[model samples]
Target: MAAENIEQENSKVKYLRDKLEKAILEKCPDSRLNGDKENRLPNTTNISFEYIEGEAILLMLDKYGICASSGS
Candidate 1:
C-alpha cells in the first residue's frame, strides 16, 4: 500500500513537471530544458534561457516567492 501511494504521488509530480515545462517553453521560445527527458528526477526541472543572466532570473522569481537554483 505504501509503495502504491508513493508511485501515485510520483506520477502526479511528473505530470505537473511536464506541464510546467510545456508552459515555460511556450512562453519563452528561446529557452531549452536541460538533461534527459525520460530519465530524470520527477520533481526537478532545469532550463536554460538564451541571453538571460541566471542571477537576474533568480532575483525576479524570488520577488514572486518562487524558489529556484541556478548553475550559472
Candidate 2:
C-alpha cells in the first residue's frame, strides 16, 4: 500500500508540474524555470518571474493556497 501510495502521489505531482509548466510558458513567457527539467526532484519546481519581486510572487501564490519558498 505504501509503495502504491507513493506512485499515486508521484503521478499527481507530474501532472501538476506539466500543467504549470505549460501555463507559465504560454501565459507568462518572461518567467523562468530554475532548474533542468530532465534532472530534478519529482515533486519540486522553482520558477522565477522576470521583473518581479520574490515576496510578491510568494504572496500571490499563498493567496491561491500554493506554498512556495523563495530560496533566499
By TM-score, the best candidate is: 1
2-54: candidate 1 lDDT, tens digit per residue? 78699889999999999999999999999999889999889999999999999
> lDDT per model, in order?
0.94, 0.84
Error of 1 at 17 (Å): 0.5
TM-score of each: 0.91, 0.81
| Candidate 1 structure lDDT | 0.94
The TM-score, computed over Cα atoms with residue i paired to residue i, of candidate 2 is 0.81
Worst lDDT 10-window in candidate 1: 63-72
Clashing pairs in 1: none
Tens-digit lDDT track of model 2 for 25-66: 789978878779787767788888888898998899899998
